[model samples]
Target: MKIRSFFTAILTALFGIFYLPSANAHALYVFAQYDGQVLSGKSYYSDMAPAAATYFEVFRSGIEEPILTGKTDVLGAFNIAVPDAPNTTLKVVVEGEEGHKVSVVADRTMVSNSSNDNFMLLREDIAHLKDKIYLHDILGGIGYIVGIAGLIAWLNSRKIKQGAK
Candidate 1:
């Protein structure tokens, strides 16, 4: 019984991962903004994004990893900035609940940059990784465990019926 429950949990987790794939890839977004650079983050959305993603990530222009990543506030927007955009492309990467990654860009220059960069860093952004695990794989192999468990349960029922007969 314990093993059976474990397998069920695994199956549920796996289904969750494969559940959505369309929003995984991103094209790009172009919007109007002042020529002035502001560390202030802009509102973004995954509305048309894949069903699996829960939040967006903002990656600084040259940084290998994202400077920050997280779910948006009620507005589906995040405000952030690197030390300066400096006539460079600012990257905003969106990560989904299911582990999909996508990015957008915001360009800016030093002359018009915002007054405060620290105001947006109230707390650091965290990555979502729980979606990667599938417990179903551990309870047993997909074919062997599920098939054997079903057969055993059936056989036990048959034997009980014969005894009654």
Candidate 2:
């Protein structure tokens, strides 16, 4: 009985450690908008840190090679003059350190007619939303921990019963 309890405890601890969220949750994000002439956007990590000096590539739809390549500024921002290719989609990919990467798609219609102020406001709203950790996320983690603990307990009980026979 004592050995079973110890094993159960160890299994629970391992599951808890593995399932709990960490700082590096692989939540890299890239957002971009095209305003007729220029394409601009930002790249950020889950903690809202700027992915400064990160390499970025822009590829047109149906093209295998990148049409433009550059690095983000200190604020995780980039701007490039997009060739006037109407009705074509452009994909912006940002690659950060430690294998972190993300992509966003932009077309001529994204911000071509919108005002600059509106675009900034939309960007700020998106960034704020991305930084949030919802209550459901916490509850889901707890549920996983509980479920793993219950499974470990059940398996331990079955092993003890089999040993008795």
Candidate 2 structure quality by residue, lDDT tens digits, 21-119: 562365677788787788888888776777889999999989999999999999888888987786688999988998987888964544445567566
Clashes of each: 12, 0
Off by over 4 Å in 1: 1-53, 109-165
The total number of steric clashes, by the backbone 3 Å criterion, in model 2 comes to 0
128 Cα displacement, candidate 1 (Å): 26
C-alpha lDDT of all candidate models, in order: 0.48, 0.79
Off by over 4 Å in 2: 1-26, 107-114, 148-165
TM-score of each: 0.34, 0.70
lDDT of 1 by residue, 1-165 (tens): 987888788777666547754524333221212234343343332233223324665565566876665665553445443454455565665554434545546545335245433333331121112222245654456668668878998999999999999
Candidate 2 clashing pairs, residues 3+ apart or interchain: none
